[model samples]
Target: MRREFKLPDVGEGLTEAEIVRWLVKPGDQVKVKQNVVEIETAKSIVELPIPWDGVVAALMADEGQTVDVGLPIIAVDTAEPGVPAGGAAGTAVGTAAGAAPGEAIKALADDMVPRPPAEGAVEPGAHGSPAPKEERQAVLVGYGVKTGATKRRPRKAPAPPAAAPAAPAIPAAPVANPSRVEVTAHPVPARVAVLAKPPVRKLAKDLGVDLAAVTGTGPEGSITREDVRAAAEIVAQPEPRPARVAAPAGAEERVPVKGVRRMTAQAMVGSAFTAPHVTEFLQVDVTETMNAVARLRAMPDFADVKVSPLLLVARAVVTAARRHPMINSSWDEEAQEIVVKHYVNLGIAAATPRGLVVPNVKNAHELSLPELARSLGELAETARAGRTQPAEMAGGTITITNVGVFGVDAGTPILNPGEAAILAFGQVRDMPWVVGGELAVRKVTTLALSFDHRIVDGELGSLFLRDVGAMLEDPLRMLAWS
Candidate 1:
């Protein structure tokens, strides 16, 4: 019996995904829970596993194709005809092989199709509300029974292929239709098959490295961006050719804004326009916090952990939010109310090659000093690795963007969408400061707080910012304030 597998909704509010690669092609045998495809959504890459054991029949989607959720992407032949449809083997097959061929096929599809979750099924959202039909139905395949609509969902217009390096525009050839001239240029270059992750691929492309020529140095002989850059330095530079003509100035290059970049653009535009932003800046002496960070690093509890000033800043923000709950809140325009969160989902804005992604530590207000340090370490590692899950990026109440990592002093940052406030941490530098009414060299850093005017007034925002700054200045105030 043949069964079709629809593209599953792997994340909340995911509408479509770009098919990155196919692990199994037509004519391959597949096992239960075997990964069949690698897909890129707006946020991250996911490996989707097929739930049933079968012989691959057809690949419904092509690599690089953007497919809508709930659309069939592959068909499989279960091909077991001797067993009863309702028996254990039949259940595993998703339909009875004993039934007539046509009947079995239809029955298998009917039983295998993803369906809306029935009552009492766990939904896939932060609030535990029932997810959309697409999300709920995806879970049906995890179990033996199937539950979605048999018909494939309508697909959007096919996405154009990724943009490539452009050749210089040439003069058009004369055509029969005098109004229309056909311009001919260089043929499109073939894409090289490389085993690097999406972020590494983006890095290599930005560095203008040919992945096929670069040697792999990562685990399992995978190509790393470092290797690509090293290869580019050795081979990418070319001597000037007398016959080569340089392209004209101001010739625009096309870049496809998809995946993380696309999503980030949309989000930033929405947040900038929707929120009435008010930014406040504060400069504080963080020498005490730096000393505390060094102390923690030498401690037995933190000996194995990576400790940084960002952890101290994060903990300070959480402590300040606890004192001023309004800072950790969202504007519920639909409900026409200001929602204050008692707990903090502290978002740390991380910049990646793909774009800016903010993955938060859940219940950060509840974590101990060492636990927060560990969480911050893990969060940064996962984010840089491009393995941050959708759930980790969701439900952030407040955020901290450490622009200091990039040697930036301070900048007014846009608030993360749905959140009321975002704090930007500037680089710590040695500057002359007034301590005990005497000017002395001290470690100083600036903090810029941007908040939604509707949620946080001038006085409340100032108080919150001051509290965080005070904690960093003294480090002991973090404990007192907590």
Candidate 2:
């Protein structure tokens, strides 16, 4: 029963995963249902488990490789009677296509964890044969396999110590292999980098701030987006750059934008170029909404939720989306069809090292205020942790990008590659405004909604903007509208 482990869809709607580390190698015998590898998706780190007891054959994917969901990561051979497992004493897994065990999969990382190898004596460089590559360690991985269907790892018959200067190899005698061998255990769990979202990482890198030195007030010693901004402000007053080494290349060091950077560049360019973006701006007087947010924080309904203007914006968008269903639609070029989604899978564009990932809340309109808040928090946290699964990022109806949090008025927002619309919220500031025909200080902010004109008309677009502004301007209208 040879098996290969396909990358499973982890949580947070992740479509692809990066192989952080491997736990097993080729030719190692493995038991069923063991941990094989630790993968980092757009959301966070996840350990993959094996399905069958087998010897590891080969690893289909390499460490740091981003593989799509349902793709093979490892191959293993189910231990069988005829299959000769390992050749060398330390050699693991006999050769045949199969999955690796989860527990025995820890490989030599910076932490120096040893993982189990793939099965059957891989004929050194040949399939179904034995090869010894002791310098490199490997781990077995299980995709989605069944339980108790795995075979035990069989140690090889030891070669007798160089007898007579290796005259002739002894004919192996059948011996009952040891039932189990103790594997080196992992001392500590992987550190979860709860640093700021993607933009913050970019901001810190651009500003040359040492992320390691900044003390994070966010949960799990993770730096929040605010932390980076604060550090930037303090340092900006004096010397612009942080105290670091001189430019070794002195004005020349054109780093090539490869890997994630290249992909992000191409993605942004394609989105801006293809999407005929019409950005409609709305400057709302959110004074009443701010008061409502403060009061909501005192209420029992919002006890577990974090209240902010963004929450209100989320509510307003959902409400407006209901009235304007086209906001929740997509423009399908291939089928020559317009996808007007009745439901809102609201996506929040997050910046991370892996690039821009807009993980959305599933069916946002159905949830209550507190649930919505909680969901948003969880989504942000998952995205920051890079644990978000491909599934969480897919099926987005519409999106909200918080340019306001960045203290910017508004940006000509680009549409998410597939979605029809994206809303960019600007910073709420106290500015002089005309109130009752008198100049007064008002907490005013801008809302820029960029819609795909192909699906949404000018009339529909204006109405959606006006409705959202009305809700923010006077939240009481939300009750009447509902």
Name the top lDDT candidate: 1
Model 1 is weakest, by summed lDDT over 10 consecutive residues, at: 121-130
**Model 1 C-alpha lDDT versus the unseen true structure:** 0.79
Q: Once model 1 is optimally superposed onto the true structure by TM-score, how far is the C-alpha of residue 366 displaced, in angstroms?
A: 1.1
- Per-residue lDDT of candidate 1, residues 1-482 (tens digit): 66667776677756568888899877899998899988888887778888779898767666877765655677688865555655664464443334433344334432343333434333322223333342124444323223443344344544666977765444465446654545466566643344554446776886788777777886446676679877777765665446756668777576878887788898999899999999999999999999998889899999878999999999999999999999999999999999999999999999987788999999998999889989999999988888787789989999999999899999999999999999999999999999999999999999999999999999999999999999999989988889
After superposition of all CA atoms, the RMSD between model 1 and the true structure is: 16.9
Candidate 2 lDDT by residue in tens digits, 433-468: 999999999999999989888888888989999999
Model 2 alpha-carbon drift over 4 Å, by segment: 1-18, 23-34, 40-46, 53-62, 65-247, 250-266
TM-score against native, each model: 0.67, 0.60
| Residue 293, model 2: Cα distance from true site in angstroms | 0.7
Query: Clashes in each model (backbone N, CA, C under 3 Å)?
Result: 6, 71
